[model samples]
Target chain A: MSPEKVQGGLEPSETVAIVGASLAGGACITRLRELGFTGRIQAIDCDPFAPYDRPPLSKRFLAQNTEIETPRWWSPDCEVIRARAVAFDAQRRALRLRDTSGAERNISADAVVIATGAQPRRLPIEPDGVFALRTAGDALALRHAVDAGAKHVAVIGAGVLGTEIASSLRQQDLQVSMVDAASLPLVRLLGRGMGARAIDWMKEWNVDLHLGVRIESIRCDHGVCAVTLGSGVAIESDLIISAVGARPAVDWLINSGLAIRDGVLCDASGSALSMGHNVVPRVYVAGDVASVECPNGSFARDESWTGAKQQGVKVAETMYYGAQQTVQPEPPYFWTEQFGRRVQILGRVSENGAVSCVKSVPDRNGGLFKVAESGAHVAWIAINAPSLFAQVKAGLLP
Target chain B: MKVALDAKRCQGHARCAAFAPETFVFDDEGFSRVREGFENVKPELQEKVRRACTNCPEGAITISG
Candidate 1:
């Protein structure tokens, strides 16, 4: 039987402190209001310009310097505060916040949603012409470098971000050379075959690839940048972009007693867990910062945009209706645009799953390949096949 | 209820259609557009339409009654 609901679900007058006002935090606020929550909401975030779309940062925004629009749901009712979360007091349901002026304050709430998200992992070497894209500011800075006539760009890391940046740079007619320690692009994330396909596509787009090598040094002298590989191969460029992935922004929660492995550990219902693995009541986690419990008892962070939004909604539901009524998560999905093609990944794509079929959509000039196991669709990868993807995804996901 | 989609803001995530196909449709290039008749939404479709609005990653959809 389903466990009893927490006696006295959240009242309309209760206050909820959401620490992070980006995609996940914004979504949580939207859902709370949709559920008729009239409570006081404190949307805390370090970014003065929070709640903006992030996917375009490396794509259209970096290439054409497109405007990163703020979410429509970011209304005045949420009471957004421009502050960085410094610490959490789980027992008291309180938070310590530091604003831009270094002023510190504490606020207690009936519930707290930790959605601090993640930050780009910086490289060991620091140089003037090097950059990493994560926020709107980062993208603008990178675009400024491009506009200032930085022709050749050396991208370090062949993961999704790296490849996407390379594609965007190529769209702007800038020469791009990519380096990754892995043998192919997205090797760890998408497996070997998909990685090979990505590398091939990048090559087709005229992006120089230096794979299966370690970076010995990245030096920027005066104006020119140089990247030296472990294989004695060296690449010269005017700029360097380190797309080395990101880590959860969980430093502030270190002393909060929350479980912190790769991210803040949370139960299936989005309730955060203490280091001893006990649920911390009224304390929740969402977005890239939440490492939610899985079937095998392992905690994993859903870092994708869709996953983050879903978690945000779930967290809101749990906060309003109580954890007993929290909905199970939907399938994982993410999309990317590169080399004039839109690629979408639905569900899980594993190399172990056999490739069931590859079909082409003649009308859209697109194609999709499916991965299945035991007559069930494990995942589907679609390239410029949104309609087909929609049908398959609709049928597969609830 | 009326739903409006900012064409400039829609990056073709196609989530609106996925959530409420009756209220939203996609263009040839996969960008989302509010279904023509959806300007005045039927009472029964309001919940789903609002769901689509809330779930949109780009927050391109807005609803007014």
Candidate 2:
């Protein structure tokens, strides 16, 4: 559909209520305004601060000792509501929200966007020294704890966020130890060989690696945490950062009657999919909270920064025009910075897929690896070689 | 209209090239660059090009007459 066709049927006076005013929510409202949707836009987020970029939380914001300034994204024209969306009444097209002051109200809208992102998964045991990074405030608090003489740090989980946090803490001259249930860090995404290579980098950075172990219990005393692993080893550290994973923040939608599995179930076009294979009209899902079913009958949730933003744009277009006008699905792209190297991956890299080095750089620990399934190229991984990644990406295009 | 890409702000998201491959191409470093001789998009393809600019998460693309 053409840009003008986006606003074809919708009236400018229509109200669009968006929950979770983070990256995805911000992108949706911005795209709507840019497309000449002169409707009343209400952005509701539990965060008291305005919408800001999140990528910095794990990197620059965590390492820096000084105050880190948040970069705002919402425009002044949008109404920013600092409140928690408690429930959604789809039949009435209304949302129940509770403000920080403990006041509750119901606001009706012509359409609703469920951009409520994911929250960090907590361990079975809750202790004072355990922390998870998901927001600007979390980063600030972690940094403060480190600055206040947190010498030994133990990071649970070896995923992108966990490893990145370990790298940042190591940069701050703290002793770092990493524990993960997986055999190797990122093995599920990068495959075994590449994951092993990443482990080598972690070891070189002096991070104590405790793989294939689960934290049985955590005991905190006098601001120090003693994490006991399944192997019966107790690691004493001043702070514990749990980068285990995240679950879609869909507790509020439990009674809302939305079909949720892993996340809010949606079709490829970002329209909420009900249990009976019917579209939940006037309600859209995006960001980490959305699990989109692909044409291949598989469901995938892209929690990356780029994925959330693209999903936001698609959801906006679908809401404005129709699902028939949805943009074409692009290959999944993800990047992470850890151990002073930038790792980029395009396409899906299955655990059992065969991988081969497509290109290499001299004297640099970087190369392009092509992952294939039964001789068909399915994904590409580039380590510290952005130029090669660009070349491979161009070759993937038709 | 002339389409320009702000390379400094791009963090290799590559949405521009993903959406409008004919008009935008990624350089060696994975950053976006307008395809050769396609700096000024044709009137017929302007809408598609505009979608690419609109979808960029970094807001690094600009279209001008």
The best candidate by DockQ is 1
The DockQ of each candidate is: 0.41, 0.30
- Model 2 clash pairs are A387-B28
List model 1 lDDT by residue over A1-398, tens digit each.
33444654578779999999987888888888877789899999888668787888888887776787766545557888898989998888889989899999999999999999999897877566678988888888888888999999999998889988999999999999999887878754565666667776888899999988988889988658999988788899998889988999999998998889999999988899998999998888999999999989888988898888888888888888785463645678888888877888877776555554477875654587776756787777888876667666556432
What's the CA error at residue A224 for candidate 1, in Å? 2.4
lDDT of 2 by residue, A1-398 (tens): 46555443357878999998888888888778766789899999988655777776787667665344433334557899999999987667689999999999999998899999999998778576688999878888888898899999999999888999999888888999999989899876687768878998899899999998888988888777888998889999998888889999999998776788999998887888777657888788999999988889888899987788888877888888754464556678887777877788898788778888877764567888888888898888888887777766667532
lDDT of 1 at A325: 67
Q: Runs in model 2 with CA error above 4 Å?
A: A1-9, A64-75, A396-398, B1-65
- Regions of candidate 1 where Cα sits further than 4 Å from its true position: A1-8, A126-129, A326-328, A351-353, A361-365, A373-376, A396-398, B5-12, B25-36, B58-60
Per lDDT, the best of the predicted structures is 1
Candidate whose TM-score is highest: 1
